[model samples]
Target: MNTINSILFIIFFLGIIGTIINRIHLLSLLLCLELLLVSLFINITIWSNSYDTLISLNYSIILLTFSACEASAGLTLLVSLSRTHKTDLLIKLNLLQT
Candidate 1:
């Protein structure tokens, strides 16, 4: 069981890395955030199941809620940028003149 759990952890960690390294698309960034959130949910669920406790479940719920809030805010900002610039590409957002 330990080996199986370790394998899952490694796969999810790889997803986290992929998300971090992928900056070509704004949508990919959102996807990567979701992937990381899924990893957090999976880790907490597995730990809670192994220990036969409810704390991990509660924590996962809270974390998911926070993730939702973050995604909403990020999407709103992205939409605003798209409206002003007419593109979602990160490289094209430089119209802000920063």
Candidate 2:
């Protein structure tokens, strides 16, 4: 059962990497980030089960919250950018004002 869970976890982790590589929608990118967060959370929990320590799980939870905050802030900024310019394309965005 643990092996099965590990395999599933790995698959989802890779899926996030794949989605990022494909440069999908912004929302999809955020979803992939959340998926990665979950994968890490599960990994830390599984490690806690084996190592009998709570530190790893605690760290994972903290990082997950940080990632959530990052996603929210990034998306909010993206929304503001899109509203100002009416576009979400990175190539067209003057993010550096150059």
Candidate 3:
């Protein structure tokens, strides 16, 4: 249990660092967000197992569903932004600029 917790902690922190460092690229940020969500899912699953209850497992499923929706929406936004600006850099995404 301790080892699993440590691994999950490392994964979560790595995702956070990746998100911070890749702020310039939309795709990288999205990938980092996905990584974070995956870590959260794993952590929740471990917790649910420890409790030996079905309720936590159900909640984890809900979390997964929401994460899937978020990923799809993010990808759609990324595709649209890249098509409009020809790049995924955040600096190039200007709504007021012609």
Candidate 4:
């Protein structure tokens, strides 16, 4: 259990670093965000293991649903940005363009 916790912590930090260092590309950012969510889901699953099965299952389902929604939204934003700008670089995205 300690090993698993340590591994998850490593993964979470790696995801944070990825998000910070890969700010140039929207795809990589999205992937890194997913990695963060996955690590969090794993941690929640492990933490909930000692509780009621139904409660843990509910938490898992909620997390999964949220992740799915987040991924879909990010993908749509990426597609729209790429279509309009012909690139997925975060630096080129002008969200407040007049």
Query: How close is each model in CA RMSD to the real structure?
Result: 2.1, 2.6, 1.4, 1.6
Each prediction's TM-score versus the true structure: 0.81, 0.73, 0.93, 0.89
The candidate scoring highest on TM-score is 3
Give the worst 10-residue stretch by lDDT in candidate 1.
89-98
How much is the lDDT of residue 70 in candidate 3? Answer: 95
Regions more than 4 Å wrong, model 4? 51-53
Q: What lDDT does candidate 2 reach at residue 48?
A: 79
TM-score for model 4? 0.89
Q: Each candidate's lDDT (Cα)?
A: 0.82, 0.74, 0.93, 0.90
Off by more than 4 A, model 3: 96-98
Decide which is better by TM-score, 3 or 4.
3
Positional deviation of residue 6's Cα in model 3 after best superposition, in angstroms: 0.7
Mind giving the per-residue lDDT tens digits that candidate 3 earns over 1-98? Answer: 59999999999999999999999998899999999999999999999999798899998899899999999999999999989879999987888886
Cα lDDT tens digits, model 2, 15-91, are: 67767574635556666777777777677777777888978878878977887898888799779877987876655
Error of 3 at 75 (Å): 0.7
Residue 98 in candidate 3 has what lDDT?
A: 66
lDDT of 4 by residue, 1-98 (tens): 68999999999999999999999999999999999999988888887885646688678779888998999999999999899999999897778996
